[model samples]
Target: MAFVPAPGYQPTYNPTLPYYKPIPGGLRVGMSVYIQGVANEHMKRFFVNFVVGQGPGADVAFHFNPRFDGWDKVVFNSQQDGKWGNEEKKRSMPFRKGAAFELVIMVLPEHYKVVVNGDPFYEFGHRIPVQLVTHLQVDGDLTLQSINFIGGQPAPSPGPMPNPGYPGPGKHNQQPCNLPCMEGAPTFNPPVPYKARLQGGLVARRTIVIKGYVPPSGKSLVINFKVGSSGDVALHINPRLTEGIVVRNSYLNGKWGAEERKSSFNPFAPGQFFDLSIRCGLDRFKVYANGQHLFDFSHRLSNFQGVDTLEIQGDVTLSYVQI
Candidate 1:
């Protein structure tokens, strides 16, 4: 099937062979891309390029090529002003011929963090700020399934942002939960209508980050922070895109509660990316999208103990649920 990208998004060519993608605004901190596909059964090599322009011989910020033609290693390098740099070789290949793979590339301030099939793979030090790279090129012995990019300059901080703890719990009454290290943060990939136990349940200042794309055919997306056992939704962030509004409500003992549908702006759009965050405050749940404070849903349920499980369902493709 042909690949259909979102409006203003780059499209892939010859899905089974090679393709070049244009990064409209380029890559920067907070930007991550997910690539899902397979290596050819008799694959020899494949390359994914981060380049500055669409023209030939343009500077390449980073070049990632994995070879399996007997010389089994991944080569990484960079080109600037037309001069090629020394090649850095990584001596591991986690890919199998003809096997499917899920790769995530996260652009940080210093380097490009790569995760292959959900595990730490390699870190390619940035030869240049990746944000300046304007195009992404993929080619060689691979069958491209899908290439997706998400994230952008976060919504300007609504106010002072809260800095949370890492790989551990947070203290009470913290304003925000800005994690210092992305690698140390816990991540989850639950099934749709997903529900998972939040270790030690909820604590003040604890936070959750959900990243995903709004489906092109999306109607609305709903996220509920509630007691896993009793199914009481404490903060139900229901963005009813069809109505051009977000409806925040709760469910108690299986009955829907009064809705909190007021918002300063509608932060969602079909075929866009959203980084929805919810942080536990002393008396209420603080919600933010892209970084802008959306609103709050005060404590409602009798037992806040069940803030242990997070449930999300709707027309969205979740990249992860990081707590």
Candidate 2:
């Protein structure tokens, strides 16, 4: 995986407009992204909608409309009423039980590809003209925690070309480097397949601060270490999953499992960093490319909660993992 470093967009939480706005002009017609939030009755009013052409309000709202009498009668809504017919796909926001749900959506030339809880939820084909999509909407009552764009600049945009002190990849910036931190510090304690333990390595953290890289790149950086039957590598960070960083995994073998969720990548590459950070949400995992997001597994698995510890095997290194 080759990570192209660039400025990213900071999450803007405006209750009045709803939805977090990504970097201006950063959104494309065929781009995909992940939106983390909770769903419930109040969510019926709140939706991930889009607006274009200097509209007075939202151009259209794409809520969970069950009784939508359209081609796809499942997740579409046309009744305009906040309430729509329900389906198995329709779920109570993950935040209700204090759990967070992540949504993966794509911007097609014509529709919005929507995936909920790491699964393909639905595809909205009502073409909102890429130029018209000046803003992304999140209405209803659910709290908007984080909005992560899959692939783009490494750092959030400097806002209208003002350009902050942010530099591109390869630039040397003062980061968390040369410390006592070891790869897979004491944050890992989960059991692996066939009774293998995830805490059987050197048990020390190697602190390597990746300078000049805001949302670290998926390529260029690699965390090499040893592996076991469980063969899982984790990048432990704060306790919340709302952190604004995405990890891209390319080289790997066997199945990949993190804290709350688990998934598969490809053949192992001896040493590689594939898991992204979920702020305080320990074990929140995803595959990345460049500084973009690819796939999101589960939220928090019981076996790996409070997993502020990151354990890696098979030639791994701990670089720029937020403490």
Candidate 3:
């Protein structure tokens, strides 16, 4: 399953190329940060920095610099006051100019574990308390796609994500308790529609994240949140390529409900990765694509607690799903 950042901690959208932004709550332990982008065609180097503040020559906690200059090595370092710290370098590069790549930097208690394209690459031990690092800067040669702040514990090992201890859906108002959604990533594959149990069930603060690619000839991509082993669907999201519309609805028994294709924007592209997130609300669900808000679907199954299984079908290759 793909790593899903917690709601409200998403990245800035299309922030001018060489991006520099504040780490909302600073770099807390147990939080994972993801940077997805492509290297420039004539790229020389790119560096990611975590520092004490945005002050001039601030104390740097971690500096990850990947160089494509002849040596082909990744350099890591830290700085205090305005002076430099010992540098750590490794000779391995997985990034290619003009090709898309996803980089994951997870802040752990003692160090930051970095993963590139789903593989463990390196670890940079902490030179300053992670909690004190308050800014993130990305500069140099690259095409930035996204920067997601996934809040939670570190990866169990170097491979698959461990079972998540996602916070529960406490009754926000007078709403009844909900069936807790499963807390781990679910593996999904194919051209056929499939349904899987949401471990405990669906609840607030719980998120459903989908990472997939729409084909060039894609017609539609649909994902539904429905009742347990039943035909009641509370939310149905279908992004139609041919129609250039996103349809939302609910299904009860065998009947299909009204369609919602009001939005005029098209965020889905053929043959590209789209990070989709569905965050539960007290009376509805807020959907997002590539960290941008898409739409919302109000509760229609009488009780939202019945949404215990997620059904996804249509024309797209699913890469990951976090339920």
Candidate 4:
């Protein structure tokens, strides 16, 4: 299948180093900046900055520097009026020399959540107003592959901008629930054995995002896309922590199909937070965990329109779900 760019954003590819550009729509809560790159083989240091302006003297809202020159560590700080704030450091480094990496900087109400290579890395509290940040600057010993800005409202806006192709309010009535069913408004702390209507059902380019934490005693988690009337599962994603494998399959006509149990790596861990996304394409479903591509499951049930419900169960506590 051909690659599909994320919804509501265009990604930049193979840009020259010392990259500087105004962030499209600026920064806002619920927005994420994704960077894919390879660290230089003989790397010393690299940094990503979200600043108020284009130049060196501009006030920085967030400075993320990973140093490998002496001791390997990541430094987080902010700059105002040419003065840098106190540094917050993490001793362990996630990037490896000469290795490819996927970095996601997710903007939240109180802080920025950084995820590296399908794992939670760190969170840096806001020192400067996120609204003042306008440009993104990346400089260091690395070869950038792509950069994408995804899922956020424009700065100064009161709410999230509607995602492309998603149905708006009153188009379909949602099932009665304790949580709000508004688009982009995350459902927090939902109980396990959870199920929700998928609104307009599945379609190419639509993505479902699930974010949560895995308990230390976690064993397994199951996420299923089901046919409401026929009780068939269009897609079943099961991550078995005990066996250290992720299994994918389908259940149609009351029988389970062949199980796919292969993956390059498992992204889930005991006591770690995870961000999982399943994007529907013309031919298959693309799965990503913590911003890293996991695998694709081809359509076993050809009728995408009939897959209208989402079900989740076992070993995880959900903090957010976006369909």
Candidate 5:
């Protein structure tokens, strides 16, 4: 969403070889470039397409490439809506063949955060559920400058140490605890935990979901998660909103429990990201914001832990996440 132009980061117009940085978390990727040594016939035909596959043999695939109209264009094929949508034109700028553009793509539960040239660009949803994306191809004239996967090291930096106040594992027997964690915008002072982040690359729940930043106010702890059809979840603090489930007697449960004590947040805007913390255990959940108490609730008769699917209906950016 934001831009940082450094002094030595010059553009590489027609880089001859492919340059790559591998991604961690056992994720695999492939890279290839079709060199149109003769530029005329392939001038307009030049295109780069990356095939995102769950595994080596999976048939379901996601495709992405710069738009065919010309250079400096970025586009993707969405499998959920079954269409090829063009991203905002300004998302990709000053495109050139063989230029050193790196896509730091992390595939989350429901969407993919795709960062191009050290910045975030788009969040493609209804994502391909496979663990690996192993194909990259440049359709024309472009040179495959270099290829490498950002493997081994943990890409994102570790969050600040959990403070003594953090409840140990699922220990919620007592109430009102603190957590030793980082608050505020992520900094690159010591190499941003992950690579550069992009805007609109994160997906958050649009409806029945509230969005906001967590400033270090008074409380400590933030809980964010998706509850399943039969589960109950709740946020306890100054203010929060509930979606899908409801608040019953003492907790938030499924089956459209309660519509009272609703919290309001500005609808998610484009190109903005927020960090949240959440803890899930047994049949109960609690949410906090920026070290403050928003609210808390519990669920009954809901087997939600097994439902791992989460989808972000709108664009939101995420610097890092802890499972």
Candidate 6:
């Protein structure tokens, strides 16, 4: 599920350079700070800081500086009592001059997970309690598009399914009250070839969210809603990048079914981040890419409840998954 902004939280759009503002309610676990912008064409360096206060002498809890100078590296550090801490550097750079980018800083219990353009970039351990860092400071060479605070918990461990067999309507387990849509714990930086059980199996209104980066040379990627016991796929969503097509089909009764290859547009691009969502309906499944509706597939199996597992494979690096 796509994360929802907290109540009364408004996103900042086209904020001026060197933007500094107090974080609403301060930083907390399960909250992610998202920034979308483009690096200046002739950029040299840029920095983002989470500090204790807005004053010049404020302590820095997390300092992210991407240097485009001769070093060509990204630096992470902290400062306290006017003294800077040891610098942590990543040699490879993900940001490009004059290119749009999306960045997410997810606050975890132990560390901050930094995702650059939908790829896991780094994990910076906390140098100060997250609650003490109440201000966000962004400056240097970049054009600000928008900044938003998204609310979501970390992904929960998959629990045992109450009923694994095909059951009639309303026979399957129900989603927990606490885990509302867009409130499921997000799994960060999951490995490829990932498979996770659906706590309540397929049901009307259930949605799955997958966010990831496609490698520059990626050929294809596949997402499957499957029946664990019989190895049958209820829905197979495959994006064949090489062919520039998205094939939708099903695998059942030991045979492949007819394919549906039509779509409004192909949203998958090499070296780009994608937000794909699959929402279950009574008769069909709605597929969306980057928040745009792409296509729909009708149910191929009589018992949609039997699709209890989600399997993802191929050339994609997942940054987040909500199932």
Question: How well is each residue in 1-323 modelled by candidate 1, as lDDT tens digits?
Answer: 11222211222322554577666445657667767677889999988888877787888888888899686988889998889899999888988898766677878788888877667888898987765676788898887756656444333445532221111121111323342111113343455776667776776656676766676689988888888777788878888878989998888888998988898677677755565667676688777665567787898875664578777888877766666
lDDT computed for candidate 1: 0.68
lDDT of each: 0.68, 0.35, 0.72, 0.78, 0.32, 0.78
**Tens digit of per-residue lDDT, candidate 3, span 59-137:** 8899999999898999999999899899999999888887777787988878999888667899999988886776788
Instruction: For candidate 6, write residues 1-323 as lDDT tens digits.
Output: 34322132225656898899877656667778878778999999999999887788899999999999987999999999999998899998999998878888888989988988767899999988886777799999998876765553222336532222312112121444322243345586789999998876787667777777788899999999999999999999999999999999999989999999999899777766676778777788888775557899999988997789999999998876877
Worst lDDT 10-window in candidate 1: 164-173
Candidate 4's C-alpha lDDT? 0.78
Once fitted onto the true fold, the runs of candidate 1 whose alpha carbons sit more than 4 angstroms away are 1-17, 154-309, 312-319
Model 4 ranges off by over 4 Å: 1-10, 154-197, 203-303, 309-322
Q: Model 5: per-residue lDDT, tens digit, 169-255?
A: 223212222421211222211221122221221122111112222222312222223333433433222222223122223235433
Best of the candidates, TM-score: 3
Residue-level lDDT for 260 in candidate 4? 98
Clashes per model (N, Cα, C within 3 A): 2, 55, 4, 0, 44, 4
Superposition error at 61 for model 6 (Å): 4.5
For each candidate, what TM-score against the reference? 0.52, 0.39, 0.72, 0.58, 0.30, 0.68
Question: TM-score of predicted model 4?
Answer: 0.58
| RMSD score of candidate 6 (Å) | 8.9
RMSD for each of the candidates = 12.0, 15.5, 7.4, 8.0, 18.7, 8.9
Q: Give RMSD (Å) of candidate 2 vs. truth.
A: 15.5
Alpha-carbon runs more than 4 Å astray in model 2: 1-17, 20-23, 40-44, 53-58, 61-99, 152-323
